[model samples]
Target: MADYSQSPLELLLANQQKGYVGIHVEQGVPVLDRDLNLLQDLISATVRAVISRYVGNGAAAGANGFAVQALPTGQNGQDFLIAAGDAGGPGSALVGGVEVVIPAAVTYRSQPGLPALTAPTAAQPDPRTDTVYLDVSLAEVDGTVDAELNNSRDVGVQTSVRLKPVWVVRVSEGDAVPAPPSGHSFYPLASLLRPRGVATLEAAMIGDLRQRRLTVSDMERRMSLMERTLLLPAFTAPAPGQPQFVPKSGVIGQPITLNGSNFAVAPVTVRFGDLPAKIVGGASSTQVVARVPGGLTPGGVSAAVRITVSNLGGAVISDDTFTADPAPAFAEPTTQFSPGNGTPGTQVTLNGFNFNAAGTQVRFAAVAATVVGVPTATRMVVQVPAGLVPAGSTNADVKITVTNPAGSIVSDDPFRAELNIPAPTFATTPPQFFPKSGVAGQQPIILNGNNFNFAPVTVKFETFTAVIIGTPSATQISVRVPAGMTPPGTTKDLKLSVTTAGGTATSTDIFTING
Candidate 1:
């Protein structure tokens, strides 16, 4: 016969006194105290109130599973017990008038490996453990368990018993489970349990356990420690005293120093916009020297320029602080005219660095010359302007200037312009013929002139032509009169003429031809 003299709480306390079972406490007092009726009423009212909010529907509420055992206090105040049914299986009962499903067996393990359940059998020749694999599958929200567990009545019950799934291992008797031939030793049933999902659940439970004992300050301290250990590279705005590139602005190809923190020893790349700057010397954690890339434009007036540093971790870009100034310099002229001399209408090519084709201006002395075509950054073609230097101007040392938006530069060497001489002309005083006149078929007569070109010369007498016999000098030429040059009259007046590459010249004095 059942003894109804003592209540369930009294029985539990008596059992605990006998060392048969344990008793839970709250604030140093047994949870199930002499006021058993009040404790029951509190539990019943809390459960009923929680379910009333979800009544009318078949939805389950209150604790996940409930039992009448004296659970340890602060083990998770929300965790309830599970009751046994009449058939010794999971019971379908209304605790505090709230329906609940008490699983047949509820267990949990917090360690890495599961325990041995069964002794070795002859047929199996391996250890086997009976396990009730609970899939406890829940839809994840926001990739975290917080949303799924938030305001949900499914609270985890703290239990010392390990609840790992059944693992069937084939091993010899009295020997430990042999190491797996390859891969991992634990081979689980895919359909029964998802290893990845289980791992995620385990991680979440560990976080929850940690959170239970941690205060707000403790959590903050732990977060700070994690941030320190991460060692993520950071780039801050350059300050006054910090190590940074000198001369924030410079021309392309100019060397600049970079001072900062957290730079790698090797494999570091510095960039100006998309163009890579040439690194100079070695780089340490806090300093680097690099030359500005030539890819930058002469006048960076349109867009901002950003400098970037890239290493093993990642890349960091600086604010648009650096500038690229134009640096137009003279390399050399294309034509190898010595002393940099050229005549009018002569095409002169100037080659130098940072020459803007469209914006560059080439000057001979103070006069701007005609640019042949669109000049390149390094080369330019221009024609010397007419009368740039006077015919006999001794001041031939004129400056050859090149100007652009960035700046202007003059040639280090001087350019010379020479004087131009006139063509040949004849003198009028000298008698054109040695004799008074030359008869037809007579000896040759000598003609005189000035400014004659150094080429073959031809002489003529009136309408009759003369034949040149010897080489002609700049002042004299010898020629024979034609046979029919004389007229029927006794004498005739005829003029003599001389022709050369320079030009044709006629003697002012006439000669008399005899019949």
Candidate 2:
């Protein structure tokens, strides 16, 4: 009764033309093979063949999950349908753009609010995880309808096999510990040290003996000196055979220079590695020139000098690498220092080689700092600022940026800091102060307030007639009456006031003070 006159493909296409994605392959007939093995094989083979033919690849080698599956029917017979997939045809040779969707309600384990992935605590599983099932179907062509669907199948008509990753697990008793193999002993330290007469207490005794080999006072002094002798950044020595080399024959026995500012100068020794280079005297932060030892090899070299200052600790700073040219020139600039980096004061130094030239002056922004020595092309020393540049990023441009420039002319990224540079507000509680009755320049006269902003602010004390001296900072002020102030009786009334950049604050009170 069904149209047996057409081929199966024609019938399938005819049904597809009617907009039917799936048609009854077997209608009203009970499938005795409930094992589903034969049905699965048939579906798989059909899908694989169709996909392969359309893809022009001779087989569905690259296709993944290319298959069709049977669905359960309401009647005694079974029903089946294809899922979402691309039908490869002449125009579209690739069976691509296939997707299947199924939704289910299930529970899943999730992770949340973990500090780190390495150590994660288990969270409660949510039962509302979405479960979507996807199945693939093969695609074919219908004459004018554009596309047709078919159940995919394998060539051999075999059920498709699935591969799952498996994890191998090992189980053991909770307290079971694995034994160390071969030469490794259960107690490694005891086995190694005991035979050498170094058991715990014995080892402590050996340590004590080794320690006692040196006199405590000598060790302590040496260590104390060594500890105090840390190298500051400004010290760098000169190399041989470089510029500023003096003729050794004339002053060959003369000292090589140690050029730097803010250096610790004392008795010094110049050396290469552990080997002493030479010994010559007269050391200062500006110059530590020692004669280069004769009979030195000609090659790259690293040398250092250790200086022990009087009362202060010894300082050891290193020299840069240089070639040893038999000929040497010596030039050193004077150490000039003023103040900078909020350092209260600044100092500069010139040491080692090429001592003289011309055209030098030290400039710092709108401020002028004094030069220490005669300005020379090789050596120019200048001072820095005493007051700090305003807080925030500040640019410090040096005057005489050229002559023997240790740093760049346009100094970039010079300084940055956070400063609470207040607009200078004056504050005080009980803003008036006076000494006890009859007390002159007496005790316990103080003004207290806040917002000092860590700056040294001068407080000008004044009465309408003459100016007075208040304390010199933002937070608090205390002043002693000048030695000459005639008091009325033992106590006298005086006016008190405070002034700042922001404005002046006055307490209109006559205070009684001990004269």
Candidate 3:
């Protein structure tokens, strides 16, 4: 037995004769048995068989040699040889030499944990023809677990099977032929014996060898428990109903209509945007309509209705946009002719924006105005029906309301309808101007009229004998005769007039001289 663990050993096996190579071994033989004198020879024989199967037997027929060696290492230890010199055929060696060289380079390049080759040794004789036998033991196949075994042997019987199953075909004595099986099955050999009767009896079985991991029931249980909590149902209370009203665009004094929907019960609130849509009726959810109140912008406005769904819950539904038109498009009544301050029935035209149609009723300061031009949708021309604004220095406001189909109160303030209060009207009570009728510088002639207030009253003198009153009151005015007017010839008839806020009133000629 060779002490393989202590030092390295190189073995050479050659096919000097034609014979089949086979594995021959016994129980308890150490794979690296250095004490066993013939261990190196056994491993060399195994390697030669493998190489001859791959390459042809006669391929190394010259001075070349092929063999195996055992180095002081593990399964990854270097162990290899090749035929060279006259022992191997020409160009048969991996490099140039008759002696086979298992170079050190080959050993270093081998993968870890896998066997490798080493440097070549001196030339050696062939061992195959001489029957180079080696020893073996059960330990030769160490690290190979029972699980890796394809079949089980009889319990504790110590069965003998080839540690490495292999064989090589032969030719003649002193030389071996290389004929290896294409695959690792014994059936192919049986078929090769009978050429035409060859049949493929071997079949490979496949299965799910992997572990049976997770089951379906486990996943289902996890999914069912997710969000296991129960939830209660939700509810809401009902609310009362209200009326709805919408204003017409660009029309004055037109009432708005109120309609309600989804007000399940009665009390509903109707709002014109922010302002409350006044409900005239007391009934809930009933049609309670009101006029579009005065004072609204001219442009488009919207009405909103919000229903009280519940006491705790505020408005569930509400209309946010609606038109609120209050004033007429046309201007207020304008005074055409100035009537005396005391008199009524003054003529004036009411002018403004949408006053196109005819017969459109115009109200002047609460009094309905008389129509003139057809009040179109745009402009309304009308006369200020008999009315009077109170007397004052400031302009009197004439409220002229128009009536048409296009909703009412389009604008709160349309424009200024000015009605100037005429100054008081005056008339002479007695038609007479006595100029020089009174004694010169002695008696003063008196004039009478009506409507006389705070303004200065003046009398005029015509020539040296004639005299006239410049400003006179309707019932009372005393004008002193000028001393220059002789009563005799200046007793001529003259017209007298009274000046008042209403106007000047004249009387027929009344003569008075210093007779």
**Which of the numbered candidates is closest to the native, going by highest TM-score?**
1
Q: Which residue ranges in model 1 land beyond 4 Å of their true spot?
A: 1-237, 241-243, 253-255, 261-271, 276-295, 298-303, 308-320, 326-341, 349-360, 372-380, 386-399, 411-515
Model 1's alpha-carbon lDDT is 0.52
- Report lDDT (Cα) of residue 177, candidate 1: 30
lDDT of each: 0.52, 0.33, 0.35
Score candidate 2 by TM-score against the native: 0.19
Q: Who wins the lDDT comparison?
A: 1
User: What is the C-alpha lDDT profile of model 3 across 1-515, one tens digit per residue?
Assistant: 21234432222123213342333456786553433423444454556545434432222222222222222333322222211234233222211111122222222223245323222222322211211111111223322444323244435432322233322211121222223232211100000111122121111110111111112443453355443211111112223333233332323334455444333233444443334444455523323344333334433232223322211112443332344333345433332222312123344444453344333456656766566545444444455444334443233444446664443332244323434323433233333534424556644566544544424333444434324344444455665555655445555544445444444555565444453
Candidate 2 — worst ten consecutive residues by lDDT sum? 185-194
Off by over 4 Å in 3: 1-327, 330-347, 356-360, 387-397, 403-436, 439-444, 448-476, 480-497, 501-515
- Worst ten-residue run, lDDT, model 3? 186-195
Model 3 scores a C-alpha lDDT of 0.35
Number of backbone-clashing residue pairs for each candidate, in the order shown? 5, 46, 107
What is the lDDT for 463 in model 1? 66
